[model samples]
Target chain A: MPMPQVPFDDRGLAYGDGVFETVLLRAGVPVLWDYHYARLLLGCQRLNIPLPSREQLVATWQSPPNAELEILKLILTRGSGGRGYATPDNSQPRLLSRRTPFVVNADRWHEGVNIRICQLRLGHQPLLAGIKHLNRLENVLARQEWNDPAIAEGLLGDADGWLVEATSMNVFWQQAGALFTPPLSQCGVAGTLRAALLDHGVVQEAAIALTAIHQVDRLWVANSVQGVWPVNKLLSETGVVLQSWNPAGHDRLQVVGHELLGYSPTSR
Target chain B: MPMPQVPFDDRGLAYGDGVFETVLLRAGVPVLWDYHYARLLLGCQRLNIPLPSREQLVATWQSPPNAELEILKLILTRGSGGRGYATPDNSQPRLLSRRTPFVVNADRWHEGVNIRICQLRLGHQPLLAGIKHLNRLENVLARQEWNDPAIAEGLLGDADGWLVEATSMNVFWQQAGALFTPPLSQCGVAGTLRAALLDHGVVQEAAIALTAIHQVDRLWVANSVQGVWPVNKLLSETGVVLQSWNPAGHDRLQVVGHELLGYSPTSR
Candidate 1:
């Protein structure tokens, strides 16, 4: 497939004026298409962007695929516009879908990945919260906090010290046999898989704090492409080992994760 | 000049993982080129993007212009990269420069432009507060609040009710005899003209609340391209007029605005 090239004046580039979704593609079929599409539409409505028809999006995905296991990134931007931040009424919405080969460390699934608390705190913006918008510098900066291969993820908290999410994934923990994830009412991208878990009646959304990390029985981070990664050790910015957990319940969670994400960790 | 075409995978579109500078071009020369370049460089440094050399950027600007009075938009994105929020170490920064004809109403200067307080509050993110990075959904949303030609700009405040800036410009108000502009330490774009005003000691950076708007003797919205626009009347979201100014001190501020912005409202 040829790589797509957008006009330089695209509002997506100009102001990050768009929303996006990344779905796992298996055998050229996008996994959890309905959920991704629903969220994409919701985001468009929230931003007042004209929603692209579902048929238009489906037609875009029918193109030939280069990889069996791939990640399909769908970006819906407010197309091109003139100078200034105001949305042009005549501007059409653009659907840009790109396929990239999916790859993840199988070893990390067996041996839980280490995680760290990022120094950068997420800003509270209820309007933009929970929406997978293109304005993701916060996640990018949080991810850049460390370059260690062992540290698979960085946990991000909002300004008020409430844990929000990992840099690119939604975080959940099992405390005394009950599942809990941070409330994303103020900030963080509410991952599709995280919603699936909640819908499946396994995870409950609550206000989890940084201090609560020490009390968790088990911890895991989940995203669409990466599936779920259990956290073996959580570290503070000053290199303090805050919490360490054994991967006792990881296999059981992976089984549920496979059902929700439509991908098995062992296949990776 | 031709419109720039960036690769679809450009991080600017994918994550708004970039920074931009819109410089006013007069007779094919970019106005306040030094300040724009400096801000762009600072933004790049803050975002950890590789800084494009001054010569390279200058060479890009040497392209023959098609418009006499134009707005030159220069976007620097962490070029094309694979999936996820992580910045690719091998990613080369891409520079996109496009020229658009500049046009503004001269009547807006004479009969001061009406402004309104935006319903959308700027989120407080100290990491991204001042630097004009590409993650500007807040500004876009704020700008979309009104389409009335009578209302030239929307004043945005932070989540804490402290006034921040207008949708696309820095705001200044005179209380008694002192000029006060909201501090950008918590939110809002620390605009080029705003910095110049602070550097020239014409505007002092302080916390200005929305309640204090009624007490202001004079109000102005400023940017590099449009210079300064005096506010004749400020309105609430419900269309109720909050503060009406006499525009008595507009000329004085315009003189200082011209000195700092390198352009005059009358000239435009």
Candidate 2:
């Protein structure tokens, strides 16, 4: 395929001035179209980008080679504008879509993953916190904090010492019989899977502190790509420890993944 | 100029995983070349993008232009990578340069710019504070906040009510006997003008509070394009008032116009 053409004045490239969503496609079909669309629309409303119609959106995904799975990226930018910080006078946003091969190691899903607490911290900007805006330097910094063979992911916290989320996923903890997740009102991306879990009555949203994270029986992170990964071991500034085990029906991480993606883990 | 080709997987476009600078070119010469290059190198160090040598950096801008005054946008993206938050393994970043015509109304510079405070607040990320990274949604949001003809540039503050900067420029407040500017340690862009002013012994950097801002006798803003403009009236949450007189070294702002661009306001 020819390289995509974006104007030099594109807000997406210029100011990191846009929002995006990466949806997992199973067998050439977008798995959660409605959920992705809703989140995209919410992002548009928050950033004031024009929301395209559902028909307009789905039409963008052209037929591609038959693959077992794919990754669809939806980018909505504030379009090309005059050379300055002020929004263009007669500006209309651009909506673009592209697809690529998806390759997730199926073995990691079952074996559970190890994560480390990142030294880089996510900032507190309530206005632009929750939505998946393009201003993602924190994620870049967090992801670059460590590059060890053992650490598969890194959890991030705000400057105020509140546990926010993983480098690329929303975090959830099981503590005291209730599922707790960090609220997005302050900071952190509102992941599609996290939203689905909440809307489906799977988890409850609550403020989780950095010190109390060790008390949770099970800790897992969720995003659109990596649906959920149970955090078996957490490495922090203090010390490392294996998370306690829990046995509950739909509350179990294994059961949740099975119900969502129709796959069962080998270890569980 | 033909559009530069960027891969869909390029981290710059994907996650805004990069840094950028827009230098002003006057009579085929870039002003503050050393300062701009230093900032870019510092930003690369902070964002982990490999710093191009000074010769390589200058080579990118070595091109004949159709316009006398041009805006050179230097984009340093963390090149192409697959779906992930981590930096690409042994990946070289993409550095592209494009030139566009520079047009600024001289009248607006001569007369003080009308400004407003934006509803959106910049997040406090100390790690990414001073660098000119690509994650600039806060500026975009603040720029998009108003469409009033009376208001020109908009001021942005951090979540903690600390005075940061404007959408596209660094702000200066002269209270009592000292010239003070907001520190970019936690929020705001460490603008080239701010750095230059400090280097040239124009202003002193300090952590400014919102309550102490009104005490400023004279107010002015500075940027690469528009050098400096004395404030006539400062519209705040409290009320609008005439800015006290303190000759900001330029009564008509033409001194800055000529000093930065080398062309008098009457000439071009």
Q: Please tell me which predicted candidate would have the highest TM-score against the true structure.
A: 1
- lDDT by residue (tens digit), candidate 2, A1-268: 6546566678888787788888877777777667788878777887788888777777766586457677788787888887777778677887777788877665556666788888877888777777888878889889888888678788888878788889888898887767878888778898877877788787888877777778787888767676677776888844465353333234464466545653444344
State the weakest 10-residue window (summed lDDT) of model 2 chain B: B248-257
Off by over 4 Å in 2: A62-65, A237-251, A264-267, B237-268
**Local accuracy of candidate 1 as per-residue lDDT tens digits, A135-236:** 999999999999987788999999999999999989989887888898888899988888877788888988878867788888998887887788899999
- In terms of lDDT, the poorest run of 10 residues in model 2 chain A is A242-251
True lDDT of residue A231, candidate 1: 88
- Candidate 2 lDDT by residue in tens digits, B1-268: 6867566667787788888888888756787777788889889988878987777778766877657777787888888887778787878888888777787656655566767666677888888888888888888778777777777677778888889998888888766666778988887888776777677675788877665666777777777776676666667644464344434343423353346545564432
For candidate 2, the iRMS in Å is 1.5
TM-score, per-candidate, Cα-based? 0.96, 0.92
Where does model 1 sit among the CAPRI classes?
A: high
Report every candidate's CA lDDT: 0.84, 0.75
- Candidate 2: how large is its RMSD? 2.9
